[model samples]
Target: MDHNIILFRLYIIIALCFLIPLSLLVSIQLYSLFKSYALTYFLLNFFLNNNKVNCNNKDYDTLFILLLKQQRFFLCISSVEYLLSLRYSELDPLYMLLAYCYQNHNFCYVAEYYYLKALSCSPNNEIILSKLTQVSSKLSKHPKLYTNDGLIL
Candidate 1:
């Protein structure tokens, strides 16, 4: 076999093994994920109502939810893609936003999870600590029941 033919075979193998998986991962059905987020904010009106960020208030959380609910899958996907590209996984603000959404929806367990994630990113945060305490106290004896949404405690 010629050198070029060997290289071509290697390229094909690489493409099949790597590129295909990469594309599969990147081309996920984002709308479905957004819908199945188990939180509300997948509506156009959510973002349309608030664009301000008030950490002390629920505005930031609501704003993010609204942004996601706006049905702008490409925009949402790109924004998250940029964040991932920058390796920004443990951002407390992101966690806090999600936590608030869960809390607001009465998914206390999920909210607690995100609150802890936020605390890990930014320790000594009074808001998060306070939330953690509040949510912790509200945790039921059942370890898996979060809400009446059929989720296991």
Candidate 2:
């Protein structure tokens, strides 16, 4: 009877350990989903607002430049999420921007992932394919580094 009680207690503890954490993970994921949806709309509005401003206006142009810079940072973070397969986060724009950064920075593996992600969304994107091809050529030339760690451009 003592053995049976101890075994039952251990089982309860194990079940709680897994079940509580799984529930928390699921809740966090759901929260992130909603947050991402909201961020998508906010980003869209930000871009739209910038576009509606007069291009010839110096103040508007300055603002636009700042916004663009911020957008690039956001894109980079998002790209990391994509590379890490953390789709729970919204990082598509960051991923696209990440491709450009990788291409220029000689991070071919990261560039490849970013390019692939962009292409996945717009399969026939000529720009993405061109970048991918360029990176691929660079990678082939330096075949000594074959791991994804080197894929980041």
Candidate 3:
């Protein structure tokens, strides 16, 4: 009876040893997760309120090179919203700056893509219409720009 009691007590101690450490590890991981979530929330809010994150000229130049020279599609596409927020009005004769930026970035397909997008907002625009015609003409020849429907020309 005494031996059985001793064995039971040993079993309880061994189970506790494993459980205590495992519980502690789990608690630590949860705490770390909560901290990570909180930090991400704070950073997101900071960037949202700040609009533009201050970067050194060299950093700006590096990003420009990456977007324009390296043809980083994501970077060029992401800037469209910010570019559209500029002072150019829908009635203005100026070229769509976002489209121009895509052009300067050598993202001609995206530039032509945005020309149609801007036209949806300003369909009667002669400048936009002319630019669209020119871009479409260019696209007809650049087989890479054609759709699955087949070549335009």
Question: Which candidate number maximizes lDDT?
Answer: 1
Which 10 residues in a row give candidate 3 its minimum summed lDDT? 86-95
**Number of clashing pairs, model 2?**
12
- In candidate 2, what are the lDDT values of residues 1-153, reduced to their tens digit? 999999999999999999999999999999976775566556545544653423333433343334345455455444344334533233344456667666766778888988888888778877777777788887884324357667633
Better of 1 and 3 by lDDT: 1
TM per candidate: 0.39, 0.36, 0.36
RMSD after CA superposition, every candidate: 15.1, 14.2, 13.2
Tens digit per residue, CA lDDT, model 3, 28-51: 999976775565445435434655
Supply candidate 3's per-residue lDDT for 41: 49
Instruction: State the RMSD for candidate 1.
Output: 15.1
TM-score, cand. 2: 0.36
lDDT of each: 0.63, 0.62, 0.60
**What lDDT score goes with residue 86 in model 3?**
44
**Which candidate achieves the best TM-score against the true structure?**
1
